[model samples]
Target: MSSVKETVDVAAPLRIAYNQWTQFEEFPLFMEGVDEVRQLDDRHNHWTTSIGGVRREFDTEIVDQLPDDRITWRSVAGDTRQRGSVRFERIDETHTRVELTMDVEPTGIAEKGADALGVIDRRVKGDLSRFKDYLESRGHESGGWRGRIRPADPGSPL
Candidate 1:
């Protein structure tokens, strides 16, 4: 398995950032390889994504969630067996730091080699950078189910 974390500062407050992160449906706008994500139930989500040239689908279960701090999840039974979390840290009222950590197992020798070469890490970083841009953009969150997600907690959501 490989793990990585990338951080970026957002011009929004901790609450806004946290709120934005919980809206799974909006993930397709910034999440790497994600084609669609929908909350199936309170604790379950259905997702369709393309990764490594393969289109895959999965049902992810939210393991733990803490408002304004962190949210963690893992794939149920699918084309991928991966788990990860995105953490939020407040740098003040207007600057929130976001950190993402993912643990994944490559499927083959070539895939493993690519992962070891940091391709996955770079891809994740690019995704996060896009997320930051999406959040700070002019219009309200694009195509997000604003009322569907529940916040993490009052403190760290890691």
Candidate 2:
């Protein structure tokens, strides 16, 4: 598994930034290589992406979610095996720090090679940067889902 983490400070307020992040379908506008994202439900989404000429379709289940704070998900079924989280931190009334962390398992030789070469890391960083630009320019979120999904185990809290 290869882990990649990246952060970007957006000029938008924390609520605006966090709300924009919840609009999964709009990810393609800022996330490079992402072709489409369909929200199946409050806790599930279907994703289509082409990265490094490899196309993949995956379904992710949101294991935990908290409004205006963080979202965490893991691949439930599909061609991808990964888990990740995005955190929103309020830097100020009009600024937010967005952090993303992902752990992906390379399936084949090509993917392993790319991971070793830091391709995945660079892609994540670039994606976050684009997200910042997209949100800052828009000044508001397209849509938002403020629903909450607690962690799977009752004993654990997020």
| lDDT of each candidate versus the true structure | 0.81, 0.93
Candidate 2, residue 103: how far the Cα is off, in Å: 0.6
lDDT of 2 by residue, 1-158 (tens): 88999999999899899999999999999999999999998999999999889999999999989999999999999999999999999999999999999999988788999999999999999999999999988889998889899887777652
Per-residue alpha-carbon lDDT of candidate 1 for residues 62-147, written as tens digits (9 for 90 to 100): 87777778888888877777899989899997879999999987777667888989989998999889988988884243332223
lDDT of 2 at 17: 94
Model 1, position 117: C-alpha lDDT score: 91
| Model 1 segments more than 4 A misplaced | 139-158
Best by lDDT: 2
Q: In model 2, which range of ten residues has the least summed lDDT?
A: 149-158
